[model samples]
Structure formats: structure tokens, C-alpha cells
Target: MSRFGDPEWGRRRGGRLTPPEGLGVLTALIGKQLRARLGSPAAPPARPDLDLALPDSRLVQDALDHCAAECAPDIVAHSIRCYAWGVLLADLRDIRFDREALATAALLHDIELGRTERRDRFACLCFACAGAEGARIFLEARAASPDRVTRVCDAIARHLNPDVPLKPYAESHLLNAAAALDVVGAGARALDPADRARVLATWPRGDFRRTMQAAMRREQAAAPNTRAGLLMQLGFGGLIARAPFGDTL
Candidate 1:
């Protein structure tokens, strides 16, 4: 018997321990080694030219955190890119808008897609409607004024409805145009090449096209009669064929 009080303890078998390491210990050791090798995830790249001087309110930070937790990394990155693009476009066009409201709408526009309750609600309504409701509830809880909450919800709800004119509301138009630019390269031609390159560099696409395709497929599977499903069934093929980055899908 070994001095450790077990026969297997300290026993060598071909220069290896008789008893293997515990599963928990081995897993922890592996995790530590991997972290040491890779270091922490790098901070998201900055786009100084597109900065909008966003508000420093805790409510905005909470909304951003909620978005990050509810959405996939690529989607979260896309939201950030949307905000930046919206701000840049507004600047280019000399359009005045509520920067913080647009940012809030952009970040939370897809929050419903990542939530179980919201997905359930989608059985009867579109994701945009669910997202608007979710954003409203979230903002209302954070003590946002009724008017601000309404504007944010309106921007989110109308983002996917191209037929609902976005004019008269800078936030709505900016969010719609920005999302369009990211999704299918629509409206991208209006942006300066250098601006486009900067945004892409700051938020590297990193399989976004494929991720979006998979998301659309899932939506189609879950709600075949819904707007998203109908659009995918009817227009996705054409979109894929015409999109500048369609080959990526």
C-alpha cells in the first residue's frame, strides 16, 4: 500500500500514475492552459470617424448589455455596426436625429429573436413585433419616459416593414437604412468607400452571412406562414442571387 493510504496512490505504471486525474481537475487544467495560450478576447475595434457621442446613461449601458446577452456575437456586432452606420449616414446627409434613441433601437431590434418568451410570442406575431414589445418592456422597467419608449419601439417595429415609409423620423430611417446596408448591401452604395471599409474593418464580418442564412432557415422552419418565412420562401433565393455577398451564403 502507498503512503497516501490507497494501493493506487504513488504507484507508477510505465512512468505514469496508476490513478488518472479527476475529470473536473483535468477539465480545469485544460481550460487554464487554453486561456493562457489565447489570452482574453480582444476589445472590439474602434471607428473614430463614425463615433456618435453616444449617451453615458446607465440605462443605455444596460440595454447594450441586454442585447449582448440575448443575441449571438455576430448579431450583436451587426447591431453595433448598424448604429455606427446610422450615425455616419446622418452626418453625411446633414440629418439631425436623436443619437441615443437610434442607438437604443438599433441594439434591441433583434432582442426578441434570442428570447424564449419572445419566440413563443412570435407564434402569433412577427419577430419585429415581439422585439418591439420586448424593448418596450425593458425600457419601461428602466424608467424611460413614455415618449422615448414609444419612439424606440416604433423604430424597432417598423424596421423590417419597407412599405411603411420611414420618412419624418430620422431614427426610423437611419435604423432601416443601416440594417439594409448590412443585410443585403442595400444602401451601401451611398456610403463612401473609405467609410464602408472602416466599418467592416472595425466589425469584421466573420461568417455573418452564413449565420444570417442559418437564422433565416430556422425562422422559416418555426413559422412557415409568418412574414419572415414567406419572405424566405419567396425571396431568399432572389436575394441570394442578387446580394453582393451572396456567394458567401
Candidate 2:
């Protein structure tokens, strides 16, 4: 058994789950355990390379659980990985940010994708914008501080527009970069190899590449005149083809 209590935490083989494979899996399992423990008051010593202090508030956990419940398994996994990558990048870049705000933004960024009724709004506006609006409503209902709600909503709104500047907020910039890295492996080369390996091992992309492609296609079909549709028309094929991970799609 792995340190995280399940040796088969992220293993897939022969179209069925399997036992953990290598030392990388063990390392990632341990890393996940450490992060979970950090959510407690008497957490273990922090790693010098990165601050693993994630949001432990009841609201934060509720948001995470809500996202997981509403989204597909692959998308939930993607959101969690985005949070991990965003914080790691923030640490590496020496960027100062609100840890809870960043965590909230990362975990709920693509939430609109999980809502079927939002298709009409998404047809007119970008999914990111729709998702941002949804996030804002949810946060406000939860009584999150006005400043935190704004920051998280803003980060979610701009996460898709990599070309636009994410300035004045490290959380937004890191979230954008992190999503890009996860989606198409953009900017992934800049991350430490070991760290990248551990993140992937812990989350295990599964069928994310194909799932993401299908989601984008659906978005395009619904909103062919929107930014997502325009991007899909322009070079989405090339982007998917260039993704570093296995293209099972």
C-alpha cells in the first residue's frame, strides 16, 4: 500500500485499475499525503522549495466538493491539478498571492462546463466568462468577502485568454499559466521535471486529453461565434496534436 492509503490511487491498466507501478507513484502518493496533512493545524514541516499551504476553510472545502460533484471526473481531476500547478508556479516565480483566493479560483475556474443550463449564455459569451459569473454567484451566496469574491471571479474570467495580460494579480496569472500547462502542455517546459512528474503521477490524466477535446468541440458547436469557437476554428487541431501527453483521442 502507498503512503496515501491506496497503492492504486491513480493506476490504470488494461482498461482497469491496477496497483501502483513505480517509485514515482510512491513519491507522488507521499506528496499528496503531506499536502493533506498540511491542511491540519499541526502540519508537518514545510518544504523549502514550495509553500504547500492550501486553503483549509470550510468554504474552500465546500467549493472543492461542489466542483467535484458537479463536474465530470476528468474535469474535477483537472481542476485539482490546476490548483497544484498554480501554487507550485507561484512558489517558483516568487509571486505573492492570497492562497485561499488562488485555491478557490483554480478549483472552480471551469465550473460552468458542468452546468447544462448555461449553454445559452455560453453561446453568447465565452465559457470562461460564464464560469466566472457562476463562480461569483456561488461565492457571494457563501458570504465570501467582497474582495476575495472579486479576485477569484477575475481569475476565472481570464484563465482562458492567455494572450491577454493577467497583470496586477499573481493568482490570475498563475492560474492562467497553470491551465495552459495542463491543457496543451504550454509553458510546461519551464516547470521542474521532478515536480511535473510528481503532479502528473498524483493526478493521472486518465482520458483528460480526449475529454477536453470533446468538451471544446461541444463548446464550439454551441458557440461557434464565441472566442472558444473562433480558437477552435483557428488552430485547436494543432494544439491538441502538440499536447505532450498520449493522444488517446
Candidate 3:
């Protein structure tokens, strides 16, 4: 078995690794992900002309307002970035989703990080139900959908696992991308400039824009399709380029 632990160990051991290197392994895996996969377009944005049914941008603006009022300014900024990325990922993947709900959920996923005094606690709570209350608070304030709210909560709960495999067709890929982005940006000490650049190249802006435009052209070449379906294709392509394990993770 790999030193990181066996793939099935998580299931057999209640998702806990033997010797508790599980946490360190998880941190290292996320570091490798950040070094290798973060920022690669997991999908393409919808055609420029497609009108997404996202809640008015004002909802995000309002969440930002409320977050700033109640949480630390750093938290507010991180929340905004997560929301923006979540919405973008949803848009790129063509997932028939409530954009407003996704953004609100993503933004608040880490709200409890503000409360944990220790790093391990912060990391642990970030992946457990401890943060659910905070996420619920954020979603409730905006009157978001309960189902979407639950999904966001679930994503937060699983954001840190080193052993859990991503559901192949689910939106978990986007959530994984977001979590790794943050960890790599902040905690990946082993990563150097060369490594970051190599990873970033996986989703180079020029390639993303070109691939997205091409996907749009292909979709429009046939009968028009729903905005969400098109985004889903884009997201799939992006994930193909940056997913943690080429064929497995």
C-alpha cells in the first residue's frame, strides 16, 4: 500500500487513517493538488449571450455586506472569492443550479474558521458539521433553497478528506477545486514558483478562453441547448485538465 494509505482504508476505518497521519496526508495531498490542479478551468463559462438565471448580483452583494458587518474583513474577502469561484464553476459546468444559492453556500462554507483558535481545529471543523451551522446561518439570511443549502453543507463537510474519491459526475469537483485553491495558496510550503507555474499552465487563460469558445461553437453548431448543459461540458473539460488524479481521484 502507498504510504499515504490504502484507497479503501477510509471506508474500512470510518474514514480515519491509521496512525493519524490521515490529517497530515490530507494536508499533503491538498498541497500536491494545489501544486498540480488548482486553477485549471474545471469547465467553461456559458456562451456570453446566455442569460443565466442566477439571483440578482445584488444577493451576492448583500451577502458581502452582511459578512463584512458580522465577520472579520479577511473572512469577508475569502467568502467573496469562494462565492465568485463557485458561481463561475457552476456557470462553466452547465449544471442546472441556482447560482445565487451556490455562491452563498460556497462563501459561507468556512465561516466557522473564524471561531477556531487552533489550526488543527480550524482544519478539522472546516471539514465537519461544525461549520454547518455557520453555513446555514449564511444561507438562511439570504433565503436560499434548502436543498442547495444542504449540498453546500455536504461539500464543506467533505472538503478536507485525503482518501475520499470525488463523485465522478457530481459538483464535488468544483468544491474540491475551491478547497485546494485556498490550501495551496496559503499552506503549500513545498510548492515553488516553478511548480505553481506548471500547475497554472494546466488551465492557462488563453487555452480556457479558446476551449470555451470552441465548445460554444460546437453547441451552437447544432440546435441550441440549455445554458446549464453547456456549462456542464465546459466544467467537465476543465476538470479533465486539473482533477487531482488523472484517472482515479
- TM per model? 0.72, 0.74, 0.46
Q: Which scores better on lDDT, 2 or 3?
A: 2
Alpha-carbon lDDT of model 1: 0.64
Tens digits of lDDT, candidate 1, 1-249: 321111122112111212232233334435634754665343233346556544677877887899888889888878888888888878767788887889899999877652434465432345666677778778989889887786787777656543223455678778877886687776566666667777777777666776677777776676555445555755663553455643222
User: In model 2, what lDDT does residue 101 have?
Assistant: 90
Candidate order by decreasing TM-score? 2, 1, 3
Q: Rank by lDDT, highest first.
A: 2, 1, 3
Candidate that beats the other on TM-score, 2 or 3, i.e. the better one: 2
Output the worst ten-in-a-row residue range by lDDT, candidate 2. 5-14
lDDT per residue for candidate 3 within 1-249, as digits (tens), equals 321222123223323334345346546555755855445433232234343222567656665565667555444544554444444444454555545555555555555442434324322222233454556566677676777566666565554444334343133445555544533232222233333333333323333323333433443333122221232333423543553322211
Model 1 residue 27 lDDT?
Answer: 49
User: What root-mean-square deviation over C-alphas does model 2 reach?
Assistant: 15.9
- The CA lDDT of each predicted structure is 0.64, 0.67, 0.43
**Candidates 1 and 2: which is better by lDDT?**
2
Model 2 misplacement above 4 A? 1-53, 114-117, 121-124, 164-166, 247-249
